[model samples]
Target: MNYDQLMFNINAYKENNQILDLAKFLVYEFELDHPNLEGFGFRDELEKNSILLTANGDIGERQMVLIPRNLFDFEFNLVINMIAHEMLHVRQKSPEMMLEDKNEREWQAYYEMLFHTNFPNVPDVSDYHKKFFAEKALEYYRRMGEGSELQAKYADQKLKVLSLIDNIQHNQA
Candidate 1:
């Protein structure tokens, strides 16, 4: 996908300010560390979907955060939580790390919503949502074990990328 095009479209929407403000708040509250974050944006089409965030490795290290622009119209905190969750994925190195990080982020987001905030009105998520997330995590782990041709091609690439990230972190220390 064209990162610039997506960014432009998102910025063109006037309601994007609310989402951006929520994102800024999350960055501050979570103390998230990101290097390049110029490519994140909210899209209208993703509304009504459970998928809150998605990252495109081919799109200049950018990510797209989707919120139910309508249902979440009153729940801005949830939108911020979703953005933070996706940011964690962008910071991941290995496929193993990606899966682990995403799971942890989801839990963190849910915990914050349930305990940290004082909404005093939000209901607990349905059992279906809980089951779906668990199943998704299992599917991700299964992919790591599969020996498909695509997996074979990317296994070495993933290792190289992870090693480079580790080396950079070591150098910083």
Candidate 2:
């Protein structure tokens, strides 16, 4: 099948202009300096029926997001969060320096993703995102007990997630 044919709901999945604009804004906002950066889409190879796969972006070779087809089943907030997370990784791997630590890389990505999630003006954030962050915090907390370095790095993110959860709760209350 062709690349477009592999995408779930290809006919209905009209790419949102606002999300694309947000992606561009994020590149500028995060100072990624990627002029050739295109917007998000599902690639033929990345499709896996209904299974949710991690959304990824090309950083070094090209600048564009390649989202998993099944991820479209989730809310736009998660998709946007994943985009932000991947963009943060692109930012982390700048030419001048390399961010080699996995935990650290994830921490930075999660930080930016949470930032977008928490920002009041950002649209499309919903309860689904709140639940996701809560689960993410629990995940980090579990990882923290494994090692001192993990504890140091992941603990901070757990706190960040808690804060985001708190904000979500506070807003609801």
Candidate 3:
């Protein structure tokens, strides 16, 4: 996919949907010039049964976003979010820069993902996405084995997130 056009379309969609800081975060992740310097594209073949949304090559060689041929089949929010999620992977500087533990890495990444998606107004993260992300957070926490520090910390965080979601869902009644 053409990075500019794809990002443009996603930006337009994001603007209409909600104000997200993801665009700003994207610029911050790169030095401005280096991000759009290489080729970015979609995958050639995908089975209808597959669950893959995106993939990429080394950040050095090129970054590929493998989207299903029927990209338009999904909702615009989900599609844009999926692309933003893939972009996060590309933004990682190096394998060595990654966190030592797999669970923590995903937890942090997803937290950042929810941050960008839910809270765009710097210093203010709305509950607009709390419900959606809380569910995801719960899933991630569940994946970690019992008695893990990561699990305990995230369990508390999930309760707070879910409580916020409940308050919002109940209209604070």
Q: What lDDT score is found at residue 4 in candidate 3?
A: 71
lDDT of 3 by residue, 1-173 (tens): 45677567656745664233443333333322135223344465466543244435553444455555555444444445555555555554234343345555455555654555332422223455446655666676777877788787677666666676687789846
| Clash statistics: count for each candidate | 0, 0, 1
Residue pairs in steric clash, candidate 2? none
Whole-model Cα lDDT of every candidate shown, in order: 0.45, 0.52, 0.51
Off by over 4 Å in 2: 1-41, 45-64, 68-75, 117-124, 137-147, 153-157, 166-173
Candidate 1 clashes between residue pairs 3 or more apart in a chain or in different chains? none
Better of 1 and 2 by TM-score: 2
The best candidate by lDDT is 2
- Go through the candidates in order and give the C-alpha RMSD of each one to the true structure: 14.8, 8.2, 8.0
63-170 in candidate 1: lDDT tens per residue? 444443442443334444455545655554223344343334444344333333322333334333433433443344345457755445445544443454455557
Model 3 residue runs over 4 Å out of place are 1-39, 44-52, 57-63, 117-130, 152-156
Best-first order by lDDT: 2, 3, 1
Count residue pairs with overlapping backbones in model 2.
0
**TM-scores, one per candidate:** 0.44, 0.52, 0.52
Give the Cα-based TM-score of candidate 3 against the true structure. 0.52
